[model samples]
Target: MRLSTVILPIHRWAEGQKIWRRAEDLGFHAAYTYDHLSWRSFRDGPWFGAMPTLTAAASVTQRMRLGTLVTSPNFRHPVTLAKELISLDDISGGRITLGIGAGGTGFDATALGQEPWTPRERADRFAEFVPLLDRLLTEGSVSYEGDHYSAHEARNIPGCVQRPRLPFAVAATGPRGLKLVARHGQAWVTTGDPTLYENGTPEQSVEALRGQAGKLADACAALGRDVSGIEKVLLTGFTPDRGRPLTSLDAFVDFAGRHQELGFTELVIHWPIPDSDFAADEKVFERIALEAPAQLR
Candidate 1:
């Protein structure tokens, strides 16, 4: 029943830093920002680089873990990302979690002037990317030649502060993606189906999430992996049109309780903005901070 939030880097560095510090003071277990060249509706709006923003956040926050909501193979080569991540882990004193995904068809997908890929092609690239990234982070002088990515004697000097490597919180919904979670992830994250949230009742959304978890459990079973070790994180503030948004303490509590029933170990809500998709009263956060910990714990 842990709680966390995502703070979009749409503000100046000073304001963003203040939010990061405030999030920690508010008792959030983790804080994140999206990793993208530019996001969907916010593409034309102000945004900052995920790594640099997180680096600055790490310097200011003491206990809360920090990371991108999800990084992907859309633009970054794993070797380069691995190097940057190891350095980030050092900066955060082992408090960095890499939330990664197979990528989606968005502004980031074509922002780098790359060819569009089908879902199958994206999955294939992700399959190669995660393993290579895993090897580079945990082993030394790794070399790989995959269909989409290659590393030539990539050296991981000084490795990561967190034992084998920094924790990987992999996002997945489909079977193949779930397989990656079973194989490499320390945590599994889901937002359920956005369309389901849009058209279905709250109960239906919970059912859909449960079904997704069941698939992930099956994926782990196939690999003889223990599902209990993997943390389950549900991103509650997924779509604006979802039934009864988490706008206040009561809404968040109800939403979190439902997901916890579905076996989610962590629940993430997005910070409110003045005028945006996740718009809400910011005071709700203060209420949650003052009241949630005792009840949730």
Candidate 2:
């Protein structure tokens, strides 16, 4: 299984550049960041824009792939986002992946002074967003209209460096979302079950993940697509176990092993932050980055 890290966009580029470079130096397969106007606890802190941070990271890192853990329709328009993504892909020399999701009712959901969308509305917008964005990136000019979005002869010249556009790592767990994953995702992403995060056991979380994966397989089968063609990714730290996976090298190996057994091809851990939800020992984090993958193999 490949190991990756999500470096939250909380650091300024001065210090953040080193973190991005070090992720490559430590042999991480890819490095990602949250895409948000403001995230949970870091809302009042010095959070940066996901695209600019990634653009800077792309300029500094040579080999490691870079992307957003997710970019959603909360405040993004497909036409504008597609343009930025193309620029990012070209700048990164094709080393970019777009992690997308049906955004939740978090700070971003209402940050633009609009009422937050209900679960159904969020899913509806996402359904419209993904396909239109896909065409925007791949076609020379797109003119379309849908229930939630409209693109009028949107022109994308000299499109993405990655042929059909950058790979999409779609985050989903629900049936409709999974159907989109089967149709368009190059990778499937999950954060386990949010309902289980506060007071559930790791075993329960694993079972929840198992059920979700089963649903994804069913979605792919319905579409006559091979489920194995989509890379399964587990974004760690939101499960009941939280940061326990990064406590030590052995702990990480065990954590990764259990998920890998569940068919997770990639595991993404958070970069250590001193006293936040992702807080952990920096040395242990680095050790796992350097050692755990070999052990898991």
Candidate 3:
């Protein structure tokens, strides 16, 4: 399995650049960041824009792929996001992946002075968002209208460097969302089940993930797509076990082994932040980064 890290955009470039370069130097397959105006705990802190942070990351790192853990329709319009993604792909030399999702109700939900969408509404907007954005990246110019979005010859000239556009690591767990994944995703992302986050056991969390992966396979089958073609990514820390997996190389190997058995092709862990929700011993985290994957293999 490939290992990756999610570096929150909480540092200034002077220091952030080193983190991005270190992620590559440490051998992460990819380094992603949360795409938000301001995330939960870091809401009041110095959070940066995902695109600009990624652009800077691309300049500093040469090998590790870069992307947002997710970008959403919450405050983004497909037309404009498509343009920025194209630019990011070119700047990264085709090393960009777009992790998108049906955004949840959070600070980002109303950061734009709008009410948070009902789950149904968010799903509806996401259904509309993905395909339109897909066409925007593939075609030279797009002119279309949808229930939630529109494009008027929105030109994406000289499009993506990753011909046919960069890979999409779409995040989904529900049926409708899984359908979108089967149709457009190069990778499937999950944070396990939020309901289990606070009260569930590790075993329960694994079962929940198993069920979700089964649904994704069913979605792929219905569409006559090979499920194996899509990578399954588990973004760690939200699961019940939380930071326990990063406590040691052996702990990570065991944790990764269980999930790998369930067909997870990639595992993403947070970059340790001292005294924060993501807090962990940086040395142990680094050891997992450097040794766990090889041990798992």
* Each prediction's TM-score versus the true structure: 0.97, 0.99, 0.99
Model 2 lDDT, residue 28, Cα: 99
Q: How close is candidate 2 to the true structure, as a TM-score?
A: 0.99
Q: What are the Cα lDDT values of the candidates? A: 0.87, 0.95, 0.95
Output candidate 2 Cα RMSD: 0.6
The TM-score between candidate 3 and the true structure equals: 0.99
Q: For candidate 3, lDDT tens digit of each residue in 148-241?
A: 9999989999999998899999999999999999999999999999999899999999999999999999999999999999999999999999
177 Cα displacement, candidate 1 (Å)? 0.4
Candidate 2 wrongly placed segments (more than 4 Å): none
* Global Cα lDDT for candidate 2: 0.95
Report lDDT (Cα) of residue 290, candidate 2: 94
- Model 3, position 268: C-alpha lDDT score: 98
What candidate 1 gets wrong by more than 4 Å, as runs, is 239-245
Q: By TM-score, how accurate is candidate 1?
A: 0.97
Lowest-sum lDDT 10-residue window in model 3: 288-297
Tens-place lDDT per residue, model 2, 12-99, is 7889999999999999999999999999888889999999999999999999999999999999999999999999999999999999
Candidate 3 lDDT for residue 137: 96
